[model samples]
Target: MSQPKDVEADLVFWRRLESQRMEVDFTKMAPEKCMAAMIEPDDVRTVHIQDIRGKETQYNLKLNGFQYVWHDMPELDGVAEQSHVENVVVPKTEALRELSLIIWSRTGATRTVTFAHRVRCLSEDEAMLANNRAPAHSVHSDFTPAGALKNLESVVPDVAEREELLKRRILAINVWRPLKTVQRDPLAVCDWATLNWQEDRVTNRMVLPHGWHELGKYAFRESQGWYYLSEQQPQEALIFTQFDSESEQADEGGMTLPHTAFVVPGTETLPARESIEIKMFAFL
Candidate 1:
């Protein structure tokens, strides 16, 4: 017998370059939604974007200037969707003269998606004085491509430390589905597991299935957003949720038992390395 392939899609994070760094918040929007950030100076030029969901995984990052073009997919197959981009432009003559951005996407339907962002007078006189010198060309020349598919089971950060850090934080694993309904019932079950590392060996924080205990204040929503904040450096618990096919399993308002943390002793009890696969919708 054959099994269905696990659901997973590429979610891309796009950023448009401007004079200064700005924060883009999606907290107020639906959790599953994807967006972009474009900083501008005086307006006149709105950042350009063609798609928020990308057709390909390849990303283009231009040097000399900080401009990013991202491509990812939407979580749901068919539902009314909205993508927003925020801009924070600084006024300076020597900074940057111009900036442009573009985002686009492809759904199963024939409809096309595209948008743009731009900024004017980015390189003014006074701005030039505050501008920082560009980094050494040798550093920029390092040709390292971005966006490589990674194994879902691969350990993140320091697993040993993560186990101990998880004690103080809420740890949940999530998966995204195509949509939310009876048709995708199997995909809706989200299982979160908490773990203790200092007490055990090999690995610390392991995914718990059929077991949801020791979950902290962290909450995971299907259409909301996911976060992981830790007070410890090497070891810390996190909440990794996104608008992916596997993200649905962790959806809120469920009757399932609350998540709890567990610990295993020594390296003998640990599995060599098992890949825990979960489906995600778009890349967020």
Candidate 2:
């Protein structure tokens, strides 16, 4: 067997938060990830991020807080290039909402509902550069508990109905997929079940266009396990959670997952990764 074997490419963590008191300029849009200009960038480490692409049963959303699944969307290739919010994004998001309901075993129950609130369209092309977002190169969660609750206020208008949904369970989910084949800068998600929340995560303030939002950054520990899918196609979607309301009360499974984008080794010649991430919530 003399086939050309691929060389090993390792990933280093670039998520050390800029630690120090600094004034933020509110004029600019949100910085991708929590990477605002800062005083110190400390303790960047080289870590092995396992590629579990071949293992189908290793991780699932219910336990690992993240899962990779097969989905069918053939028509969205050209639609992604046009980048139409209502035309392209709305329909894809509705599909994701349906997927969320079907996989979690809470479909068509009394008051069970899922809806998307925000969507981020990322690409390397010049035409889609309005938001100026590159893949977030740091490990972080999209929402903190306070930020999720604040986001809920904007999504759910009726106060009484919001209160009723709050009584059961609330979940914040990120549905991410590549508009094309992923050539470079694949995403890596950490196993939250292995992490000690109070000891392993740090809350950092991110300045958004609207206001500041709280995001969780990681403190790298030997106990933590990180993984990334290999060669994800357009029809594949990675579903994960950023906030789980019952996280603290649980013994295992159902918690927030933190993730980041990293350069795949020897992929410099390939096209840059273009993907869309839809952030949504489920009330059950």
Q: Cα lDDT of all candidates, in order?
A: 0.19, 0.64
What is the per-residue lDDT of model 1 for residues 1-284, given as tens digits with 9 covering 90 to 100? 12222322112111222311223334443323312221121112111112212221222111111112211223222222222111111111101111111221212211111111211111122221113111110100000011001122132346774444333312121211112111211111122322111111011111223221121111222231111111111111111222122222323321111111111123223322111112121221
Q: Could you tell me the lDDT of residue 283 within candidate 1? A: 21
Candidate 1 has a TM-score of 0.16
Displacement of residue 107 (Cα, Å) in model 1 is 34
lDDT, candidate 1, residue 183?
20
- For candidate 2, the TM-score is 0.77
Native-to-model Cα distance after best TM-score fit, residue 172 in candidate 1, in Å: 1.7
**For every model in order, what is the number of clashing pairs?**
62, 0
